[model samples]
Target: MVGVSVLEDNLKDESLILGLLDRHPIGVAAVFKRKIVFASKGLARLFGWRREEMIGRSTRIFFSDRASWEAFGERLYRLLEERDDVVLEWPLQKKDGSPIICEIITRRLRPLGDDWIVLSTIRDITAEKRSLRRLKARSSSLRLELSGALEALRREKDFLRRIIDLVPAGIGVWGPKGPVLKNELLRGLLGENIPREIPHLVGRLIRGAGRVFRFEEEIQGRHLLFTLSPIDDQNILLVVEDLTSCVKMREGLETLAQAKASHLLSQERLALMGRLLAGLTHEINTPLTFMKTNIQIFGAYVEGLRRLLEGAELAGEKRKTIDKIISEIRDITKSLEMGAERIAEIITSVKNLGRKESFNEEIDLGQALHEALILTHNKIKHHLRVFINGEPYNRQKGVPLLGVYTTGRRSLLVQMMVILINNAAEAAQRRRVKGATLEINVEDIYPRVVLTFRDNCGGVPEEELSRIFESFYSTKEEGTGLGLYILKEIVNSLEGTLEVECPKEPEGLLFRIVLSGGGGGVERIFNKTFYKGVQDGHQGIGTG
Candidate 1:
């Protein structure tokens, strides 16, 4: 009875341990002679088999090949003998023939049998193996990306260094300890002798001492503009630009401008002198004309008197007295003739003074007159009423004048018109003529074009009229009395004449200009008339 109870107790303990092993999370199995004798539900589920189907099956069925299965069994058994337990990770096959990785923990068991058995705990580690493989692939990808980024960064650093070296402006980085980086330009500017003050300047710049330090300094006889800019807490950028050429160029330009201004002033003075000389010459010509004419008449009369006295038959004393008187009269006549001839030479010289000799060119006198009128529009536009007769040229309207062409200096003609128009304006203003009318007529008379300037300003007194051509004889408050004198000289220069008529009849004062005409042909384009306060905002200018 005692033996039977002991054996039953032993059987009960074995059954309880087997129940706990079957309920574990991992697969459990017992193998004997390469055949599965016991298999937990977990092991059967892992192999996609039922417990009943796997329990009696050979372990070889779970292996893809017989050699691998045998090798695993032998390794497991040999390792289990040396250690308490043997662990192995192996490639295995499921019941459906799919490959998997498994971790098997095994121990050798000696039961009441001659054959050896192994109790194994298996866990399917396939998911964990796949995760590990993915992690390894990601590590490789990250390594490649890191290598490419490092190469790109190196290239960028090299490109920036090359740019700094090649720039024209001197560039340097200065820190508290002085220059930390210097480009080629900066090195050349510094040369072998760096100033002792540079380190102090750099120290001040690094501490943010001022807004921007910029000044000029001479280095090696070359003027340079140095600028220091703060870059960071400990460093600053120093830049230098050469300004020697710019200063020299500016000085040269100033000197040239001054010389040009002086030349212009000299030219203007010469022009004024020429105008005065021309007026003086005209004043002298008028007196010479009358002197020559009267002298010739008086000479003829003296000859007639001498002939009559000789034929009358007088006594000795009376005849002697008469002959002496006749001789005195002849001497007086000879003196007058010689004096007039001497004055004539002086008049010729004054006329040609400061006058530039130029070849005559053909120009439309009417056109030149129009240009002069436009230039003097401000002087006459508001004060006087002006009317022009003839085919007038309007530059704005593209209308040209007729056959009023003349062979002369256009500049001289234009100047003459300016003087006449201004004189007329002054006269009108002086006389205070209401509804003042100044008429201008340009007519082509075959070989000559006659231009007339008539003004309704009160006529000059008879005494003043004769002296109008005299220099320094003016009727105006501001006049230098050279206007009419200059006008006469201009006419004479062109081989033309200026005539005046003042009878107070149809017009107040009449002045005529006659010029020789020469051009290819004649084209009578348009006629224009201008009146004061009539055509406002109109550009065409004319007077009749």
Candidate 2:
């Protein structure tokens, strides 16, 4: 009886242990012959079921599919045979037909009532598994991208190396340690022997990368120009070029330019001297004209006084002595007047050769030409008879020039006219023909004032005509060759045109000057008579 009581106590202890396993917080279950005989409350909760509902259910009921249940069983049995316990991740289901991933640990238990028992501990691991799957997929994608990037980088590096190698200029790339890349051109420059201090030179170049560095060195008996530039913090590039041929060509060009510039400066200085002479003559002639006129008046007064003294009744001796004195006084006054007139004429000739106009103002073409003729009278009066060939007068356009008015720097036009008149005079003197004439015609031709100078001088050669307007080109002895050239320039600056008609039908040269002004436009005076009451004998004009 005591033995039976001890056996009952052992049974009681076994029951107590089983009860504790059923109430565990984790899902703990005891399976006998693949059937659930005991299930913990935790296990029932994990499957969304009551403990009593799972107690008598087949373990297959907890698997989502028959294939999964059989596969898990096979794996569990194989693993259990090798070890005391096996853990597996599986899709578990509940009574409500919902699914979850679970971590299941199965261990072999002692045989109970002739059936083998397997104890299993189950926990939901769905969240961790899903995260793990995502992480694995991301890692695989990243690995593929990295592989492609690495291949593309290698191809680009190879292509860049090939291109840099083919360039004609010597190229070298230096890294922190030393030269990392170099082209064939650089190798040729270095030749069979490399410099010992090249590494130091590269180091200095890298440190001074903020600015460019240049050094000259003789290699293979050829002068080489080396330039160093920075690529980045740790890399620098060096380029070498040969400039021996280019330097010779540049020096030759510079020498030629200097010679041409010197010739131009000489011509310019000569022209300036001519202009200065013209200005000095004009300034002197203005005052000299009054001086000559006053002297002439004083001579006339002396003559009148002599006559009055001669009319007086006096003794023979007194009359003879007084008359001699009066005669001497008259001769002296006449000589003084002649000297003044000569001075005026000399100044007028110089004036035409040296003056420049500084500012523009409205001027009447007729009056301007008339004044120019007076100033150049001494130069042309003997060889040429000149006249304006137009109507008597027009108050608005200035008399004899009828309806011709223009705006320009007055002194420039006057000086140009003087040059043209003097040229005509010279041409006539060369002809040696008496009564050689030059005619000036001013016309208002629709928004322009046209001044034509026609002379009876023998024409210039056809070949020479083309070059007459060029500076330093002359057709006469003592000619400066700047007259026509300067005239052309002034006309151009005034927005005017100058043209020549050489060897025209009448056997004379004609110069035409067109300036931009004729009473605003021709339409303004369309109905007005251009040359009213004109007369004859006003044909050719000339320059001395």
Q: 1-544 in candidate 1: lDDT tens per residue? A: 3222322333345444444445544577777776777777768778888877876678888889999999997887778668756768999999899998888877665543565666677767787677967644543343333223322223244323333443346766667876766767778876765666667777776676774677787788877877766666666666676678877889888977875686578669978887887877777788789989999999999999999988998999999999999999999998888778656644543343335645497666655766666656566866666667734333333223344678877667877887888878877777777777777887778677788988877778887788888755688878766678878888899899888878576447788989887434343322232222135443333322
Query: Over the stretch 162-197, how does candidate 2's per-residue lDDT look in tens digits?
Result: 434433467666667977667777887776555544
Q: Which ten residues in a row have the lowest lDDT in candidate 1?
A: 524-533
Instruction: Point to the candidate with the largest TM-score.
Output: 2
Clashes of each: 6, 17
- What is the alpha-carbon lDDT of model 2 when measured against the actual structure? 0.67
Name the regions of candidate 1 deviating beyond 4 angstroms. 1-358, 390-400, 518-544
lDDT of each: 0.68, 0.67
Extract clashing residue pairs from model 1. 387-543, 387-544, 388-543, 388-544, 439-544, 440-544
